[model samples]
Target: MDSSSVCHAEHVPSCHAEQKRSIHTGWRADVWTASSLFLAKISLRPRIEVALSTLACMRVPVAFLLVLALPICKSFYCYISETLSTACMPVVVFVAPLCNAAALASLEALAKQPDISLGVISHFPQEQLPLHIRLRLAAHWQTASALNTAELLYAAEKMHTYFGKIDVLLSTNEHVQEALALIREKFGIAGMRPDVAHNFRDKARMKQRFFEHQIPCARFQRLTSRQAAYDFVEQVGFPIILKPLCGAGSVSTFFVDSYAQLEPALAQLNPSEWNVALAEEFISGAEHSLETVMHHGRAVWQSVSRYLPNALDVMQNAWIQWRIIVPNAAEQVAYSDIRHAGQAALSCLGLETGISHLEWFRRPDARFAISEVGARPPGAQILTLHSRAFDCNLYEEWIRLMVYDQFSVPTQRYACGVAFLRAQGYGVIKHITGLDEVMRECSALITDVQPPKLHATPTGTYEGDGFIIVRHEETAKVEQALEYIINTVRVTLG
Candidate 1:
């Protein structure tokens, strides 16, 4: 045997002896580990006392043992408490300013949830938010000079500086879903990816996917020039829908029915206003929109609403009173194809966990054709109407969807409808002619009503001035109440 292999204590070197002693000491932590570890928790005082009591119960020698472990328990306690303090609180960033009713309501709803905080990164200032709503914003909000991608990223970095780092990004604004998606990808955060958002934000691309999937969607053409518009007219004929490729609502949308009306509608398209415009063969049908909350690339809940006069008609005629009703009934046999096509459309878009506001057509033959899908919450007070109709806090649901990646709320309970008050002509609001009459006739059925404000600016965006919401178990009653509210109320602009 060599000297290195010797096991005799007398023959062992000083360094080897100390190594052997350390091994013995490490192995001897038997009782200390069992009692001290069990009791040495974040609750130091009580844990130490209980651990000491446990050792006493075990009948171990304990006088110096408790004293030795007191400091160790203090260190472990600090570690655990520190971790618990910072680990649970998540940081959220909102893309849009909390100035509008929708943004404000969503913020308030998010505040009520546990273990989350929000920091705003937007083009608007904090003062833009109403005082009450501004008070709820987390840490603080940092405004970017522009809503462009570069400035947005810088503002987000500023937000990160203030709130630690972004854990969730709430993409609530229209026409900027692509920007939000890019930011999410660059930062390697949890949110809508760029590819998925492209399919939503880009209309031509979206329609192309729908067509390829054998999903029933109206044929569309991207308008590059006057020649392209004319070519589309000659090829697809008149009665086509002309709208901004990436716009929401009906801001600059035009419905060209006759051959003579095509150029005037094309004249509405300004290269400065929009980079691209699309003209599609308009499907003649009853226009309705479906609101879906998706999770893990699957739709978890869906709500269908019928658009009064359709959005195209609403845009064409300013006097049209727009109302969307969410019927209480689920699984309508007529809408089966619509639902199936909507699902296929969304799957192609790769909506993993977000809300989709899809508008489709039910033709005279009852066939379905998707008009468009917006990868955002439904605007025009539809969310609030859904809340009243279904008896679920949809604003709360928005927060839960964006922050928690969850859609556990019930989306349908009662049939709900909203009649929007829009200006018949361009001017400031002078007066709202009917309220008492609406209440007298539909008081029991009315859930919410905000009369138009005086001197308010009006642009044709579907949601103009104010709206009245009503709900009931009966869908026909809800429709009747909407008809009453629209016919009864008149917004005067001078």
Candidate 2:
């Protein structure tokens, strides 16, 4: 039969129609009842709305059928192939950082089923994907830097297969704004606007909004020229920090301690490339991060992490080490304060549902000041640490929030922390000593260690040499063991 004829045949009001049209008067009533039940079963769910919408805009019936078949096929395969819940869960497309080994592993672990798809938009090539995998099986991957009209169209086409509609579209890089806009327009996906993404990506704009909102933050001046930077330094005085407005991973971030050092630092910054830089008043004291999950513009799940040596100090001194301590709800007063500020900041920025990573500095006097906020998860395996420590998978929690509007609340069975190893100097790896002794000493708390690779470069700004993640119900014991590990372990380089 032709495609239209098949469509009409399947969509018939009842099997009685076929019986009346044909000479088969002896057809059983049970057959008609079963057919009606099957149609009703498929039509009642929300996914059908998605499937029908996907089909409405397409002209090719075959392509539409293939597209509609993905989710159904996935559900069937998962039901038979794996030991997971058959209940329908909303699918989410997670766009994550490229070459992030820790994040990828954590995400894969959290997605109990294949409901969460990964998309990387960076230097990675699409052809590198495994041949056995369907392109739709792969998270609609693309490069943010090279995204164009064609790529967006291609993504829309590819996404049309598995998903009739996308519940959420999460992205990081500012360059992918056009692509995200295309996805929203084509697929009716709901998410942050391209402008909101841009604002979050651009440090200057984000800081300005925080300032207008009367939020507490370090004083910052945006500079475009050497003279402009000089004037700002003159006004802000010495001991300020300089960083690229659009940079990540703490690259090109420098601290100016004296007036004489300003010119050399300014010369290192490219006016055409680094176009703008921020000269901010340095806040001293311990540093911490707040991981928040917002839904419909409200902060629902929040966790605070206290950084051991502070991020700036860890970046400045190569040998200095740091650890992240995730405290239980009852013990985290400082974190509670940070969460309050973070919610306010999200509201001011008009951020709705999604994950937000916010960094802040806690003063000795107990006041907290906002540093920065990213629209994605915290970097350097924070998600892993949170997951293992709490026994709750944060990546999966993020997916659930995005797709199903549900948040995973940790039972707070234990506190977790990770100590990042820092090299004594810049060089190739000679040897890593004392790991066995360190592990023995912190055996109760130490859970895992990432050994340094051979010929590894010394850890510096934005580079994570490696780290040891530890967990325990007793926060004091966890902290003590972490401190001992940091002190006893030695990383010698050639």
TM-score of 1: 0.79
How many angstroms is residue 259 displaced in model 2 relative to the true structure, after the best TM-score fit?
Answer: 2.2
Of candidate 1, the 10-residue stretch with the lowest lDDT total is: 20-29
Specify the highest-TM-score model's number. 1
RMSD of each: 15.3, 13.8
The sequence of per-residue lDDT tens digits that candidate 1 reaches over residues 173-275 is: 7766787788788777797888988888788899998888988889998877767778888888878878888877767887888978887877878433346
Measured on C-alpha atoms, candidate 1 has an lDDT of 0.73
Evaluate residue 72 in candidate 2 and report its C-alpha lDDT on the 0 to 100 scale: 88
- How far out, in Å, is residue 215 in model 2? 1.0
Candidate 2 lDDT over 1-494, as tens digits, reads 21111112112222333321211111112233355468677756687777677777775587768887899889757644432331133445544335355435534543454554433333343333333222222233333333464645554454445344455565443345446756666677777766776677777788899999988899888887777777877787878888888666566788888878777777777443348777788888788888888989888778788887777777777777778888754676546667788999888876798888888988888888998887777776677777776787777777667666788677666778888876666578778887889878777776778866768876554345778988887778778878887888777788
